[model samples]
Target: MSAAAHPREREIAADLRLRAARPPVARLSRKVLLVGTATACVAIAGAVAYAMAARPGAASRPELYAVGGPPPERLAALPADYAAAPKLGPPLPGDLGKPILAAGAPAPTMGAAPSASPEQQRLVQEGEAARTSRLFANEAELRADPSPSNVGGEPVVGQGARAVLDGPVDRRTVSPDRLSAPASPYLLQAGSVIPAALVSGIRSDLPGQVLGQVTQDVFDSVTGRFLLIPQGSKLIGLYDSQIANGQRRVLLAWTRLILPNGKSLVLEKLPAGDAAGYAGLEDQVDRHWGALFGAATLSTILGVGAELGAGYRDSAILRALRLGTSDTFNQVGQQAVGRALSIPPTLTIRPGMPVRVLVAKDLVLEPYSG
Candidate 1:
């Protein structure tokens, strides 16, 4: 029994040694080990590559933000801070409602921040996400200061102001509704007639007030208002009688008066109103003024100096080409009150514009009693 068992054990051990020493078994084990090592290395490398590539795009995105300038209404406009902004409307009573302050409230509690409303949060989020989004093109910081040549000029410190003039309905003219201004309005038609006959013929026998004096210039309150009485002042409108407490509120843009002494007067006043309104009116004036006064009757009849007698007036730089018998003014007059026998009428262009015009007074020439 012992001998048989021993022989079998010896044979089994020999067979095991033979299998371990075989070339194919050892070669196959080596190949298997190499493939397993390569697979482990690839898996490890791929995980690390993914983590590295994702860091900035993921974690740093929230911290990346662009700094921008303050909004337009805030540009150098008075009362920079909201608190300093001028209070419009009726003044608040001495006592306003109490603003109950929470003594120890957290600066930033969970869920939502106290300082920002939902709308504000949306704007902030939009601005923060703008670089990657299509809301506005990408922006980058450009320092205007800490430069060499910028110091000498009106250096824009940080980001300077910007104004855009593009929009629908160019905001550069007095639209029809603007002329009837709130305070005072003037009607304007470029060279309309002055009704001299109407003014002279319809004589009012009412008490007449003498304006100019023959004496030397001094302060006189004759018309119950201030009056400067010099020949030079009289030639011009140095004295204005409040002709009824200025209830007659029309601003004359320009006028021409051929005084008895043969002096021409050309006066122009500015259009006054809201900033937007003034800008619009100025734009319209620049666009249409030359075309306007070019063919009116007043341009013709007020007749150029060349057509008048020796002492004829009307000498102004604006009137450089104005002295032709048929000027832009006379045609306007003819168009206004047609030919021959006519009553007195007046034409005026006022400071305010409504794209149209309105007139409250008439002009008629009157002969002085000698």
Candidate 2:
């Protein structure tokens, strides 16, 4: 029992010593680490300096080029006595070359006057005297008073004198070439109106025949009792479909007139009018604002899409493809916009719209008996 207790006591003592003893921790000092880092940096700097100092200097700059020699002479190294070939045409009879060569020579200085012959001197003196006499004569004429007979109360004017107005003048007066005598006693003269109403609708989409019915009685210009065009007469006409931008009127003309009794007359291209006597009919005008706005919006969208991500760098092929696509989109957008702009405004005149037949010329017709 003493031996077993002695072994247990030794074991307990060893465990106590192990628990009291602390293991050593490996910790690097901040000063030592800083010192080692500085040393390494200094060595690296020294190596860099040595490398720089050992490298050879750059090559010397090349000297500037000397000025070029003078150009070669034009006539140097040419054959001596190189005369021109003989001329193919004969010369003129007179010595015309002398005057031409003399013209090219240096002109004489004006320091001294040329010697003049006696006749020339006489001519010059006579001319001076005549000029002086003329000057004196003009002065006298200007100073002389007019005769009492010529100085009348009214001023005298030449027969060619005429009045003129010089401002921006236009032909305000026209000849009466359009005026004409009445064709017949039973005639509807110019400035006359035959009231009517549209029998068919007018759409500017396509050109087609239009129909109308006279709504009022038209009479001859000579007699008030004569009835030329009665009410309910059919008017066969055509309306123009060529619409322009912002245009709201539809031009139409009557070509033939048919009475209720079946009697027809072939009328010329007589123009249509409104109640106010204005040419063409007006009702509805469609400028297609929605279509225009849509086109503009589409163009803007295409432009924005084309310009997206344009700042980013890309490969040559990609860049080229992007530019091509951008240009294609841009062109398509522009074409779409242009096509929208080119669309003309639509003019519509609904049925039952009041219209008039303006008589541009004389119309001879038999009085309606029915």
Candidate 3:
């Protein structure tokens, strides 16, 4: 009669005691889970792309853009005819409807034949005739205006140049005359030359002074017996630093002359020349070709890189960044090229270059006692 002796209890205990050894069940790895998730995402993205591509719409129509939300489903109803609809404000004092209709009418074709009553045609013809008469009268008045007489009938200037040179040229008598007297016995007159050699080198990168030593003695023009300027005199001048493209000369002019005897003369912008009487000095010119070529090469590379960086599938942010970068590069390249072009050519004249001073006016000076 005890509970431990029950047959059902004994059977349950026997079932609990029974056990078996089985093989271990495998688990999914992190790599497999990640790969499965990635595959599902790709399939979903592909389905969405296909749906967008297959959407029904006219190609020529404007593309659909996202809005804040769908348009109100229950909008206020509009009247069947807008013209018959009631206006909110009081009526204007003028006949607004008539003016609107007239404005909307098609404009008359230019130069078309008149299509009107005979009276209107007559008025239009009279108006045109009056305008024609006025124009002709104006032309006649212009012709009748007083003008200078062409007595000698000299050659008429061509029509194209009439606007530029329409006035009568003044006539003056030019007489040949000789000098009443020479200004001074020691005068070094025009056409006299002073030979000199450059004492200081010339580099046309900036505006600066140039020095030269007189290589020979200069005598008076009248008698050629007195020495006006002594040898070894210093010539002070300035050379033009502005260089044009392909230019090979250095233009310089003497402004002062200093003699070895401690005397100086202010020469009036006396031009300097080479021994051959040509204006300006010939020397080496540095065009900065290396810098120019480098800028050009860099510009080409930047332009090419900008074009290569663009792609079809790029996002808006990437596209904007690319565009900004490209613009910056293009601007920088253009500026570099401009800077290279703006660099003036450097002209260099070595010392001892033979030069000449051509006297353009009389130089009255005491004969060099030395």
Instruction: Estimate the lDDT of model 3.
Output: 0.85
- In candidate 1, stretches whose alpha carbon ends up further than 4 angstroms from where it belongs are 1-41, 45-256, 259-360, 366-370
Q: Candidate 2 at 214: error in angstroms?
A: 0.4
Model 1, C-alpha of 168: deviation from truth (Å): 31
Provide the lDDT at 322 for model 3: 92
Q: Candidate 3, which ten residues in sequence have the lowest lDDT sum?
A: 130-139
Give a tens-digit lDDT track for model 1, residues 233-253: 221112122223212222212
The candidate that achieves the highest TM-score relative to the unseen native structure: 3
**Native-vs-model 1 lDDT?**
0.36
Q: Write the per-residue lDDT of candidate 3 for residues 171-190, one digit (tens) a residue.
A: 75775685568888989888
Which residue pairs show backbone clashes in model 3?
Answer: none
lDDT of every model, 2 decimals: 0.36, 0.82, 0.85
Model 3 spans with C-alpha error above 4 angstroms: 1-176
Better of 2 and 3 by lDDT: 3
